[model samples]
Target: MNDFLIPQHVNSFHRANPVAKLLCMILLFMLTLFTHRLDFVFYQMACFLLLLLLFSGHRFWKISLIILPFLLVFIASSSTMILFGKGDTVWWKWGLIQISQESFYRGIHIGFKSVTFAMEGLLFVLTTPSVALFYALMQKAKLPPKYAYSFMASIRLLPMVWEELLIRRNALRIRGVRSLRGGMKWLGILKLYMVPLLAQGIRRAHRVAVAMETKAFDGQGERSYYYPSEYSKSDIWVILLLSAAVAAALLMSILLPPFGITDVRYR
Candidate 1:
């Protein structure tokens, strides 16, 4: 299942060192936060969207499904400010609900910012793998192997845990155990499902801990990695691409006609 979910065609972004990619993402995030102009934010979003479409290596429908939630995010984030935010020029007012020119601009700016953040995050996730990320953290970022390996183990265990839950459900069905309906359904789930799952998880964790201890995982001795995380030309390309995106966004924002909003903070 996990193998099917990942794209078969590995792009340059996917080949880049995870630590370098992470740092680039953090820098982009900080830049977006400092950006207050609507035009700039919009262009930043456009750049990210273009990058995602070009390099994600996924089907159009799959990419669309991944980004569908951000539509709701844009709406929810913009609506609150548009309806209730303060402004000098009132457009419409009905008791608590108010719409103003300033508020409308501000809301749109905020919506664009939110979507830009989401796109950047999706771009990272679509390119980077969980296993690669932990390995990169340990190798490139100087993170302790014990912590990195523990996180990797936990992530790898998730699929097995999900399978166990499905098996338990099937077993109950075979035993003619009907699911509880109405308000008490949740309580029944806690008693019948949650308790066993929690106990199983605890026992599994203990066993893993014991196994790690036997292998001297907690020790400070140097160890070789099965999957080596190393810097390459791909990392440099990733950095250059991101830098170009940022530069292009700034250039477009400057060349395009302003939305009459210079600084959103002043408004």
Candidate 2:
């Protein structure tokens, strides 16, 4: 989870143009939406998971465990659709809940589809630095300076907010407040933390704004970047290969129909 805040050096994804990475992730997700077959969606999920493992600089099991609850929730919710949604062959029936072969297969389709998309999104987040992405938006995507700087400032402020929360909690501990392991005490602790944190946040925002102004970050003027980021041939190759993979998955779906959605419901 901390990896989201601090990106690690692992592969070329770190060096890729942020605009290109963002576009590629969006395009890949669009392709996943077009895939109706569970097998194709699983293929997409596997590809993304592999990429994450290869480039995220984190252990495979660690990442899987972090996302396991989300995957389970998606699977449960989607599979429940099999019990409630329309289908032909009834496999089970109880209190308005029913499961049919068609519905079961459909559930698998939706569940895998959700997993595939989430994996891709996590990959993008783990690999791309938020600052770099926002800067790329300013440079390549032509985002206005005011919006870009505001977003960049917010991103930089997140850690400070978290740190302030921690400091307040520690101060409470020093003042003879025992940390509750659980129960209703956590809510009270949260309430104690909020007011000071809010004031600190406002003060920090003012300081940041003042600092930015002193650095001549006027929203209307052209800004210069210390780091040179631009689209390159590699970005084109990344998109091209992704497109080809989508085309190949489609072809495979057609040729290997059994590996995809079937017309016959389970008997």
Candidate 3:
């Protein structure tokens, strides 16, 4: 059941220009940051979730499971601030902490804004592949080839790092070594595990550097790309649609001032 909602690797959007997706996500992030009204934030989040259901092809519950904990933590911290801060209509009182209507509203606003930002971020993470993003950056964003290749190489090495760590752990296990389970000291765990992982990472980095030099990867000058990224009509549509959404949100905030136009500050 959960598998059905998982995103297909070979979707049309997956093949769409990564630059467009990146720019659209940036617009959404800007919207998340500037909007201050809780109602508007909630409305935006709801719309994003609905779109995710329709288009993400990823399990809604799985993403929610990853997102909710951070949201809850943010809410808790915001609630703490509201409880401690001064406000006009006090609901509860303690020696240093007091819950009041103004603080409560502000906290709610902050919490919802956080959710809006997280949802936008999740959309990017779920849709964009790392290689595609790096390729787009190099071709479209005019990022230096060497820097882009280095960044992509680092990302590609993550699986190798994990594999090496697992192999080390299994070997240790076979020799009756134990991890920092059941309240063992973390410092000891780090000494046992992290040092080897660091060594392996450094070794891999050295090999990658050597390979890049072998390929004559000078950061500057002309280079040919095997998978040269190009903009398409779909990319234009994506950009226009997202830009329009951002503009519409801004316009709505202006016309309906109460929705989100006002600058909210904790007072």
lDDT tens string, model 3, 130-163?
7778888888998888888888788778888889
The TM-score of candidate 1 is: 0.88
TM-score of 3: 0.79
Runs of candidate 3 with Cα error greater than 4 angstroms are: 1-6, 9-15, 59-77, 171-185, 243-264
lDDT by residue (tens digit), candidate 1, 185-208: 778766777788888998998899
**Global CA lDDT computed for model 1:** 0.87
Best by TM-score: 1
Shift in Å, residue 166, candidate 2: 2.4
Task: Point out where model 2 deviates above 4 Å.
Answer: 1-12, 54-70, 171-190, 262-267
Candidate 3: clashing pairs of residues: 5-57
**Poorest lDDT segment (10 consecutive residues) of candidate 2:** 258-267
**Cα lDDT computed for each candidate against the true fold:** 0.87, 0.74, 0.71
Q: Which ten residues in a row have the lowest lDDT in candidate 1?
A: 258-267
Between candidates 1 and 2, the one scoring higher on lDDT is 1
lDDT value, residue 245 of candidate 1: 95
Q: Rank the candidates by TM-score, best first.
A: 1, 3, 2
Against the true structure, candidate 3 has what lDDT?
Answer: 0.71
Model 2, residue 160: distance off in Å is 2.3
Listed in order, each prediction's TM-score against the native is: 0.88, 0.78, 0.79
